[model samples]
Target chain A: MSETAAPLAAPLFDRVAIVGVGLIGSSLARALTHYGVARQVVCADRSPEHCAKAMELGIVERATTDLAEALEGADLVVLATPVGAFAEVGEQLGPLLRPGMIVTDVGSVKQAVLRDVGPHIPDGVHLIPGHPVAGTEHSGPEAGFATLFQGRWCIVTPPPGANEGAVDKVVTMWRRIGSTVELMDANHHDRVLAITSHLPHLIAYTIVGTASDLEDDTKSEVIKFSAGGFRDFTRIAASDPVMWRDVFLNNREAVLEILQRFTEDLTALQRAIRWGEGEQLQDHFTKTRAIRRGIIDAKQA
Target chain B: MSETAAPLAAPLFDRVAIVGVGLIGSSLARALTHYGVARQVVCADRSPEHCAKAMELGIVERATTDLAEALEGADLVVLATPVGAFAEVGEQLGPLLRPGMIVTDVGSVKQAVLRDVGPHIPDGVHLIPGHPVAGTEHSGPEAGFATLFQGRWCIVTPPPGANEGAVDKVVTMWRRIGSTVELMDANHHDRVLAITSHLPHLIAYTIVGTASDLEDDTKSEVIKFSAGGFRDFTRIAASDPVMWRDVFLNNREAVLEILQRFTEDLTALQRAIRWGEGEQLQDHFTKTRAIRRGIIDAKQA
Candidate 1:
């Protein structure tokens, strides 16, 4: 490993293990190599084909199906698999983790991370759960690029009494790869994400599903004339199915809570439309427009 | 007016009058000028400032508040106002239209166009209602550009037995301005748009409305973390309020119909989430994924 780390410079991990070489994992590998954030990235995947592809694409220094082998010498282990796999991966990696090693993850649902992966971490090992609020509709190793995380927010939910040095190390690595890291509690992160990410995705999937159930001709026409607003839902609905499925399953309570509110709001809007209440419809639409402006002002739009 | 009209080339009208100088209308004027689709473009707006802005921005050759003056000597009158104003605009322009003139509109809802404007056309004149399935979230003359309609679909719903010459003129003009025009009945257009555009916008507005009602601190956090999925809805909700309000009001029947289906589907998903039916959620989400692929294949995503 390179040893000339300055006070503010990013410290290179001797070996970094990235579990599940999908879009997020492969993207982290690419960014680490591109920025020299780590000396070596070693990836392990359950699918041998994905491991072969990762090695062939040169996204990592080494690729293997043996999780223990991949984590043998790694100072930083990032579990980039779907949240549903966190418990199993954590159990597998727990016995192999070395003292002073940092364990992080890129899971959308944060509370699940603490619940699933927290208990398995050994003493002296840091557990920093992160959610990089960035992605595209595409998935897999081939779909990832080094610039995927640039100018995006990465929320880190480090456990209480966690090692500050380890958290700062993970933050520095993310910063080196061009992400703004923000710290928040896992529960708050889950709730905020339920509204902003999970609920929106669920609604998009539902709308697109409704459209898909239409007659063939009408469905074709919907696809043809999607430039209106349905196309946006289609894009969001196309995101990685496994990841989203795991998201809904893991973050069930928060998702169900927000979805209940969405349903009530939609039902009210539906009644207003049916009764031709133009004033009410216009009022709600106009109020929503203000929130949109605030998002643009916040530079997140 | 320039008289160098080739059989299939050159200006389709001596003068084209646009009733509103917002994004769609201004973009149409700019495109007409850029492609020489009309010899002169005249604009009228309820706001005197908008008219002046349109003229200053060179989106129209002439601007006026008097709908009568704007329609003077114009062989083609385009009612580019909100759908809610079609009836009033139609009534105002009915007596001013010259014989054999073509009256059209760029509104999202088509049935309302027929219901409001169909009776206003004078003998020997034609009403060819159309909607260009394209636009950004921005509004006003300054937000428009000459190439806004390039490669987009424009649906024209000409009345049965309408003047063939007028239909051809509108089709030729749209083609020259970089739109692929498709002819369909007005009622069918409304039904198709209800599913594709109106319902999606209504849902987006409702979801964003839900987010807006969050507590002040949570609302601010939602805006900051909006890049996840809420950002897309914010952009959609940021669309012109008056225009969308008009859409929901004008296309009440079909909007309510499609909205009913969407709400039912959302309820099913909500129930699935509440019951922790992972398979049900996965099945629906997976099915929706294909529709997105179809949209991308159709080049609309």
Candidate 2:
């Protein structure tokens, strides 16, 4: 991630296994090896092609389609698949988990991870859910790199009364990969991300969809002149459809609540424009600039 | 500008005057000098501070508060003020324009430029309205650079029965300054840009405005976790308020029309999410990805 990270003195885990070796999963695998955070990093993916690509790219020491084989002797198991696959994957992964093993995930919606995978986790195995707020529009194993988590925030949501040691290890691993770690409740994390991540994506998808439905001539011009602003939305809308679908389906309540608020604000602005209320529009835009300034000061800009 | 552009054989215009030296205006001034497209670049601004800043930055050869002073004997006059000021500027500019002088503008909405500035142009003066599909969120003279329009499209909307020689000169100047020129009707240009530029800015401003209205605790979290997606909207929403305000006010019809379509599509997607229609969401998201590819292929991404 950051060029200034100090070299790791020792591996944090003896054996680490990542499921669904796509963008985030493969990036984690690369980061673990690149930073020497794991003695051995392996991955299991539903797509054999991704497993082959991960190994071919030397991102992981071992790659396989079989969940049990990949999880064998893994002290740390990361479920990096889409949230929709968690229940089925969790059912198969439960018996494979050994006592003292720590299981975590990097899904967008954290509460769903708890609802889908929490019950399937055996009593002795730790199930700590985490979401790293970092990724590109690209997906699949080849799209990942070692520094994807560098300078990014990783929110780890450990269940109530969970093992402190297990939570600490997960936090430490993220830190070793150059991420700042924050711990929050699963419900709160979902609410925050619905506004910060999910709603932006949904709006982007909707706008891009609107453009695509325009008359052919206008649609082509939209693509031609997209450098103005629409191109940014296109990039966001280009993100993995399956992953985003699961994000919307799983985090319905929070996303919809925030989306309603967004709609109300939009309608107010639309009214301002219709009525030629320049002062109101300018004031709203002016205040938002302060938030951008705050974000820059926070180093998130 | 692309590294492949050939050195200019000679200056395209002598004594170029740019009114309202803000972000796009200052950049154009810089580009005219950097590419040796103008023999001398001068700017006029209502704000004395901006005029001084432009001179301090060496973006213009001469900067003045009086539009007439800046346009003195200039062969080319570029109206670079916000569209909202075009009518007032045009009223003042009408008598000062010399015969055979080519007048153009760099506004976001084309029809508004024609409506506001068109009638004031006298006989023998060419009125060509243009919109450069480029810019950053930054504003003011200091925020501009010579390459802002490089590899971007410049839509030139010349009225019927306009002088061909004047049109060619305007198009040539844009090409010399590192832009691809496309000629179209003013009405069509407004509609194209309504979807491509104005609508995106409106949505971004709306969403960032929504985030700004959140409670303090959640607001801080929005900034903290902004990297997920909201950060991009913040960046877009950080654009100059007055300029964007003018954009929405002038381009109301097209912007509102496209906005209605966007809201309708969003409602459909919202319903699909509420109903747990994963297939519909995935299919819609998947199709939008193709438009991103189209942008990338157009070399506009």
Candidate 3:
């Protein structure tokens, strides 16, 4: 047992398969290989162009369109695809997984992953869902870098009674790639992310869309003057449409709940503006400033 | 006359008084002194600490809490105070201004600046309301830098039939300090900024405020996991509370108009999310991506 543990402590996986080669997937591929955590990194992307780019970028040792082909001899399979496709992908991936293999995902919404991918895990295969709370507005294979996950938080949501070794291995990989790992319940992950990620993206998308529909002259001016704050929203709104759509759809309950709270707060502020209630407006704005200080103190700003 | 023309083409003002010595005010003071556009930069701020800091920082040659004292011997008076304070400041400075003195402002809301400061302008004084569409989230006198206005757009809205020489001097000063000056109507400036600046700030303040009110455990987690999106909002919402509160109050009509549109659009998106309209959300998200590309192409990103 000690002899077997020696190699297990070395490279975590001999062959690792990333099932999607987008921003997060490509970043992981580069990081795993750069850290020597995976001996061989393979990519399976539905987009042939992404697969080609992944290979050309040298982030993956091999690229394939077939999930089964990518899974062959792989000890770890990472579902990096959109959350909406997770259930279907899990259905296809269950039959191909080996008993000792581990299946992990990089979805933003965690609860949906448990509901969608939990049933498909084979009797002996371990499943751990995670979200690395980091991203730029850019997407696609070429947009990723090896250091993308550095200093970021990666939350791992492991189902009850799951293999302890499997959970530790996944956590070790994230930490090796320079992420601070946190073990959280899937439900709590979804709720927290709804406020932090999902609601912000939704608001960004809404505001940008509203600005885009302005008169042609006004639209041009909006772009010209965007440094005023709208520019930041535009960058957030520019994130991958399909990915964000899946995030909102998959985490509807938490997102909608938080969003309802947001709408009420916004309405109160709006009324304050209409009534020229300077005190009310100033009070709210003052309270929000403390949060930014907290974020700076926490070293997240 | 030729000898006078030589220096006339040199420093624009013999004594420039900057009221309110805050971020924009202090930055302009630095720029004016750095570019030798003003012979002496004097500051008048309600906050004695800011006045002392402005003088200590060497952005101003002298600082005073007395507006009349600072404006003495000043040929140019820049109202750098919040719009909410503009009317009161203007009323006090109106009788003290000498003939040929130019009165300009760096207010966010142009129409309100004109409405408040216009009536107080003496016959020889020029009231050219301007908004330099640039700033960082930081505030106060020390936060100002010489290059704050570099490559940014400055919209100058001179009331109809205003003094051409006054307008030209203000425009030339901005251009010398590296701003691209554009002549726009005060109404148009207010409307455009409502979408680009005011609404975005309001939304950011609301979202960050919402997150700040979360349960202590979740609030800490939100900060820890902020790289997802909430961090951007926090930065914007961290802006000076009094300045933003005044902006919303002064430009209530225009801000309310754009905000009404934004709310309706947000509601539509919210309904889409409720019904799981993935395609609709995706389409809106994709369209907004084009706006970011437009901003990049415009070199405003």
Candidate 4:
């Protein structure tokens, strides 16, 4: 018992199987290995190219297309695929998850993970859903880096009555890889991220879509002058399309709720602009500065 | 005349007067002096604090709160104040202009600048309105840098039948300070910026306002987890409130037009999310990525 307790204190997973090898998955594999959080980090991606790239990039010790093959001997499994793929992946993944193994995910929307992956988890296999609130516009295995999770917040949504040791181990891995972990309820996590991530991405996508449909000459000028502010939206809008789509679909209620609030607020400002309400516009704009200050103070900026 | 040719070839402004002495104003002063584009740089601001900072930073050879005092012996003048102040400042500025002096602006909206400042221009004085499609969220004189305009586009909209030599001098100044000059009409410049700059800013401000209004608990979490995407919007929304407020009031028509289109697009996306149209959302998201690629390829990213 003491010998077993000693290994648990180190919080090292003997094997970690990351199923995706895309940006987040590949980055996690790199971080787990680079930080010595796992004895071995293997990945299974549906795309052969991603598997090849993962191995070439040396982010994972071994990369394969076979999910079962990757799961063999793994004590921890991480689903890094888009949320839309979770149900199918979990259907196959549940049977393969060993009783003592821990299954977690890196999807942006959390409640959907619980809804999609919860039933598949074997009774003894612990399930924890998480979102590492960090990313770049770039994607795929080659874009992954060992320090991708450094100084970011990783929110974990563990099932009610789940194994405490399993939850602690998952949190430990994230912290070890340079993430701050926050334990949260899946529903609350989805709601928080809806405002923080989903709504922002949806707005970015909408504005960019509108800009792209402009006349050819106007379009070129728009691209040329984008540095003013549009460039930032473009970068955010350029994030993984499938991933973002899944996020909006899975987090529909919370996203739609926040977006409805956003539209109402936008309409008020629009009316103010049309009516030449300068002071009103100024007051509203001034209020937002405090939020940015809070973010900077929180060191998230 | 041949002796004056040497100075003209240098593309230098002698005794330049910059109004406002804020972010864009101070940055222009720094660039003018740092790149030897101006023989002497002086600035005037309504706030004496900004003038003091401008002089303390050595960004200008002279700084004063008196616009008339700053314009003495100046061959060139730049109206860097917010567009809302253009008419009032132009009234004060028009009488101070000399016959040979060329006046330009670094305002975001060009047509409004032309309208507000154009009527006040004395005969033989060139009024070439310009917009350097660049800035940070930071404001005030001290938040500026010499290279703020470097590798950026400075769109100049010279009035019809404008003085060729004066236009050339303004264009040359922008080029010498490391901006690529695009000669555009004021109407077109305003329309283009309506989408690229104004609408994006309005959306950012609105979203940040919405997020800021969330219940205090969720508001704190939003800021803490903002790195996902909200942080970018906050940075943009953190821009000077008065300046942005003035922009919306001045560029009302163009901004409202683009904003109408943006709202329609956002509604379509909202409907798509409601109906769980994954493919539609994915396609829309994918198309926006092309615009980002265009921006990157154009090196405006």
DockQ of each: 0.80, 0.83, 0.85, 0.84
Model 4 residue B119 lDDT? Answer: 92
Judged by whole-model lDDT over C-alpha atoms, candidate 1 comes out at 0.88
Pairs with backbone N, CA or C atoms under 3 Å apart (clashes), candidate 4:
none
Better of 1 and 2 by lDDT: 2
Query: What is the descending TM-score order?
Result: 3, 2, 1, 4
Look at candidate 2 and give me any clashing residue pairs: A1-A150
Q: Relative to the unseen true structure, what is the C-alpha lDDT of residue A125 in candidate 2, on a scale of 0 to 100?
A: 94
Model no. 4, DockQ? 0.84
State the C-alpha lDDT per candidate. Answer: 0.88, 0.92, 0.91, 0.90
Model 4 over residues B139-239: C-alpha lDDT tens digits?
99989999999888899999899999988888888888888899999899889989988898999999999988989999999998998888999999999
Against the native chain B, each candidate's TM-score is: 0.96, 0.96, 0.96, 0.95
TM-score per prediction, in order, is 0.95, 0.96, 0.96, 0.94
Off by over 4 Å in 3: A1-9, B1-9
Model 4 residue A165 CA deviation (Å) reads: 0.5
In terms of docking quality, model 3 is: high
Docking band of candidate 1: high
Better-scoring candidate (TM-score), 1 or 3: 3
Error of 3 at A100 (Å): 1.0
What TM-score applies to chain A of candidate 1? 0.96
Candidate 1, residue A239: Cα displacement in angstroms equals 0.9
Residue-level lDDT for A57 in candidate 1: 97
Residue by residue across B243-282, what tens digits does model 1's lDDT show? Answer: 9888988888888888889888988988887777878888
Which stretches in model 1 have alpha-carbon errors above 4 Å?
Answer: A1-11, B1-8
